[model samples]
Target chain A: MVESSPPTRLDALLDQLATDLEPVKPLDDRPTALVLAGLFAAAVALVLAWLGPRPGLLGEDVQPMFMLRSGTLAVLAVVCVAAVVAQAHPGVGRNSQGWKVAAAMAALFPLVGAVVAFTDPAHARAMMMMPTGWQCLRMSLMTGTLCAVPMVLHLRRGAPVAPERAGLLVGLASGSLGALAYNLHCPFDSVVYIGLWYGVAIAVAAVAGRLVVPRLIRW
Target chain B: MTSDEATLARLMRESQGGNAQAYRQLLGLAAPLLQRWFRRKVAPHELDDLVQDTLLAVHQRRASWDPARPFLPWLAAIARYRWVDRLRRSALRNHDALFDDISVESGESALIGRLGCDRLLALLPAGQAAAIRAMKIDGLSVTEAAAQLGQSESMVKVNVHRGLKKLAAMVDEDA
Candidate 1:
């Protein structure tokens, strides 16, 4: 019986498989979307604290400075972002404690935000209605949250589908969604410039999210 | 009230019967696993599309899953098919058996394709090949891959976090 030439070695086999995929670019700039979001979340919360409650609908009464209270919620959002990032990482939940930590953090974002908003809504009202940059900041904050939403959704779905343009997609969704949802209630200031269509500007920030989140996380 | 044999297994069964609640539950249950699996295979960015497609497939063909079997194996089959599809699109579809291809090439040029990637690649969960392909070959910015694939950039980042480690291990094994 003729024996075939000796089979190739396994070591040699894998060596043949390597190609110019290159080491991932250093994570220096990547994955910043979440961190910046966290930072922004905290910053927005801080601004609200200084500004005092978010505005009420239809321009109701204003309230006292309640930055500290809102700060708690903002802090909670940052923690939740970190924890969610961790939770989203593989194998962390198997440890049980990691799951609890992540769950707690996730639960806390809205929880703390709600508690502060309810316990002393004046700050939320003030911040919401300030007419100053607060409105835009609030919008940005919400936009960030929206951007994060799909990522969380993607994770829960359990397949890494973001093969390309993750940050851009996030930014676009956030920008359009934020603009669409918020612009509905826009004061429009009687100029009726809605036709001027400035809402598209929000896409820039969403684009930023697309670039930033992946780098920091380096997925 | 299905007792846990892992979250997806129970939900997969219920979802097959067209239970939206069960399907939603299955989506949640499957999400993290899919994220981790895809992350391991590809860059952090591509994860979003991978998850999106997988979920859409699961939702679209929920009936194909047989609850009588282990959820993971079925999911594994789904994942494997996805990987193969991706491999064919990229350059990694293996025409030769692992043993057969080992000796045909040499030199650093050939070394790119010949590096003991299989040893380390096998060490990783099978799903991550897609991730590796996106980052390495397709030259996608992680953000681009993440958005296209419908996953968190961070999730994608974490999945490919260990390439250097895996490579190091392979190098050590080779030595």
Candidate 2:
């Protein structure tokens, strides 16, 4: 049987579209860097305006554990931003090593906290449920919300093949940024408090991203 | 990747930057693949419509393509979505016709039925009518209709709801 030539309509449509086509501006080569900078800047501004940085952030009394907490959150934020950018275009990061790296970083803080808590058995229970855990959760979510708007706008500019995945990355990135910002103000030096409360806030942000991204970026 | 894939990717990137020639070339290259893809599932006559629909979707969503990624996968995903949407609409059209046939047979004269259908559709603005046709008569999901119409999903849903409500009001007045 003669296969009819592929329809001419495609040719006509292409011709029509070509006639109206406008030159597209070049995409930013490092949108992830730009977005990360934006998120950090937003978070820092919020920190300075509302809750000043931790009193001892630069003082000699600053604990070593505080660095670990903030450092881990920063790593998560950076890795998640990379993954989100990778996913902004579907099929770009099929291997998705970035996500695995982000996940490992996310796990590290909690695992280290658990180990430290075990070493100090008497204070373990109290540190596990800090009195200000809710405050951390709220502040982290607020920070995530602040960062999410700009991140989502950036992601929307790209063609994300998987809206859910794209949104998830946005949420994770935003949540991490939020936690990083909250860390500046959070006084609790206990690893357990940082691990549990910051984790909750990031999870909430991730879930929110999953729910909201698909709708916002559908083009 | 093959040279063709690399060329396609370059074309897509260039197209994104407003090179009309590259955009045309990219679509030209994509058309055959889309035709083959759609032909596997749909009738021969419906082939052009599906191909056109997929191309339109790609045009609208082109900004989402990442320059670093292979272009074929992005194009393939859009084609696949449009094909599945066609299958869904085909199924719904059949199902709706079964019920619509009963109503047409029961009371309305054939001429009146035709007039009523045309008149009701005409009552709506072009955008609303197109939305109603795709969503109501054609059985497309709101997302599917939105993509086809180049409108947001919410806008499609709103148009369909409002168009149908108005049609119902008109029927009541006629009665």
Candidate 3:
């Protein structure tokens, strides 16, 4: 056999890095997704049992619209989670498409809300701002903070090429899940409140993620 | 897809399992490829250093590797990152200080008097090779080289740096 090239300082560095190396148990995305889903479910259940769904949600006329709003929020949560997982692996193409899809969905909610509020003319201003706006924002943020813990932990297991992007996705995921949970407790069925407050909550989490992820995930 | 790649993947998998021997063997196997890759981007004297940096990065970040994915793309991404880092650092180096260190006879004009550069030039990427030919071998200024190549002056500087680095690697390899 041909002799290998003479060893260099790289050999030493490699040895140093590999010393006391333990086998890494591979992190699968499926389990992470399940855990996030379970956490979101638990949060929603707790909120429902404690405060109950919006008072008028049981009525026939309001129930369908409430279900529709909650369903949209749930879909947003799932998409954000998928984006977060996709960004965890290095060398995987940047999940721009996933981000774009999430953004479109996010944008769609607000645009639809604006149209509905303006057309009604009766409650447009009232729908735009509410006394409970601050509460909704707080609840969403609280939910996001709780959910971000697991999301960040899962992200730490992988080599992310873009930490900021990964963080933003994590924030979006957690924030949306938080909004979904908040939706269970929020009695206001007005599209304006849901669109504006929920959007801001997600944005806050995303900005926080962008700032925190690079530092948190750096190897 | 190739057997070489398959073998490399196997070695990486073994290395991830805390196999030092396999890890060492993997680094050894990676050296020449890393050398060639760095050569196309940096100078000869810097080649070994960049290669070492890449190796260290690979070692430190090895845990992030997914066994399900092919190994080379992951390694390439790390190498590319290191290359960009080196370029950024080089750009920050004091140019006047660098110029003062070179002897008059070792300037581009004198260096172009030699004929052996063609063989080495052939080994570089097209953009870098052309940049070197116009700026170094032909003794054109950066502006002239940029105009001749229809590229930005900064781009010409980058190409020249990368080409010279590759030529230095060839000399070192031959030596």
Per-residue alpha-carbon lDDT of model 2 for A1-81, expressed as tens digits? 012577465566788998888766534537647765876787777876787877798899998878888787888887778
What C-alpha lDDT values do all the predictions have? 0.42, 0.69, 0.68
Instruction: Assess each model's interface with DockQ, reporting 2 decimals per model.
Output: 0.03, 0.17, 0.17
- Model 3, residue A133: distance off in Å is 1.3
**DockQ category of candidate 1:** incorrect
TM-scores, each model vs. reference: 0.28, 0.67, 0.72
Native contacts recovered by model 3:
0.25
Where is model 3 more than 4 Å wrong at Cα? A1-5, A15-21, A56-62, A92-96, A117-122, B1-3, B42-46, B84-175
Single out the weakest 10-residue window by summed lDDT for candidate 2 chain B: B96-105
Query: Docking category for candidate 2?
Result: incorrect
User: What is the per-residue lDDT of model 3 for residues B132-163, given as tens digits with 9 covering 90 to 100?
Assistant: 66654344567777999999999998887876
Top candidate, metric TM-score: 3
Compared with the true structure, what per-residue lDDT tens digits does model 1 show for residues B41-101?
Answer: 5434455666666555544334334444456544543443354344434333222111111
What does candidate 3's lDDT look like per residue over A181-204, in tens digits? 988788876677667777788888
Off by over 4 Å in 2: A1-8, A29-32, A92-95, A111-129, B1-3, B41-49, B66-70, B80-175
* Chain A TM-score, cand. 1: 0.33
